[model samples]
Target: MIYFDKVSKVYPPSMVALQDISFTVEPKEFVSLIGQSGGGKTTLLKLLLAEEKPTEGTIFFESVNVNDFPRSKLPELRRRIGVVFQEFRLLSNKTTFENVAFAMEASGRTPEEINRDVPHVLELVDLVEKANHFPHELSGGERQRVAIARAIINQPDVILADEPTGNLDPLNTWEIIRILKKINELGTTIILATHNKSIIDSLGRRVITLEKGKIVRDDKEGRYVL
Candidate 1:
């Protein structure tokens, strides 16, 4: 459902985030992007989310050239994809339920639809009981779960999570992985960028390794070789 053709991203002067990266992710696939810091894993996610444009080449989402997506149509493009950053960008002032509800509201969903979908997403992430709590009131893992809920509240076609377990302990890390696996099984295409070797090893799915903005390895059932 996603394709990158000769994609290269270079910042002003010469900071290359991705170089000649080309790949295709079929619909419903679970893929892990594994690499060390500065390998451009997060940069790839930003490109896919259209947070930044490619300095050269093109990005296509389900055959639509995302690189050329109109500015006014960004929301439509974003609605099809969900993004979760390592920082768990939840609004501190909003309750967990409201945070997820806010996503639905942005999509112009009706109140009835928001009420119906918000709880379902929270339940999916196992944050149903904590829906009334604010970000500070919840533990780190719970807060990330809320972030995941908000990301998926719209039933997005692709889920992009960048270093989702960056701040969690081992137990919480596994919990987040389990939820991601469940979401994948439910048919949401999952693309996770992580530096955690054990998680990628255990996942045993397609893994793409990037180094200095270039993909050095692409393997099925891959290991963390970097």
Candidate 2:
């Protein structure tokens, strides 16, 4: 449902975040992006989300050119995609349930819809019992689960997860991965950008490796070979 065609992003001066990168992610597919620090994985995700424009080439979400979207249309584009970050970007004052509900609220969802969907998404992430807890009250894994719950609450078509397990222990990491896999199984396209070899290796999914801003490998059932 996403396509990148010869896309490149360059910051001021000589900084190149991505160089001539191209790939396609089909609906309901689970894809892994693996690369070292500053290797352009995050830049690729940003371009897809239209947080940054490509310096060259184009990015397409379904058939619409993401970079061509006007400012007013950004919310509409973003609503089709969910994002999970390494740091649990939850509001400190908001409870877990409220954090998940906030996305819907921002999108102008009705109170009735928020009430109905928040609980269901929390259950999907196995955080139903902790819904009333704040981010600090939960463990690292629980916090990340809350983040995931929030991301999926709106049922976005694609979930772009950037190092969602980076801060967790092995057990917690696995737990997060399991939740992501479950979401993928339930028909959400997942684009996971991570540096964890063990997670990538174990996933055995489509692996796209970048080296110095270029795609070096694109393999189906690929292992983490950096």
TM-score of each: 0.98, 0.98
lDDT of 1 by residue, 185-218 (tens): 9999999999899999899999999999999999
lDDT of each: 0.92, 0.93
Can you write out model 2's per-residue Cα lDDT over 1-226, one digit (the tens) per residue? 7999999999999899999998999999999999999999999999899899999999989999998899898998888899999998999999999999999998999999998999998888898999899999999999999999988988899999999999999999999999999999999999999989999888989999999999999999999998
Candidate 1, overall lDDT?
A: 0.92
Clash pairs for candidate 2? none
Q: Candidate 1: deviation at residue 168, Å?
A: 0.6
Residue 146 miss distance in model 2 (angstroms): 0.6
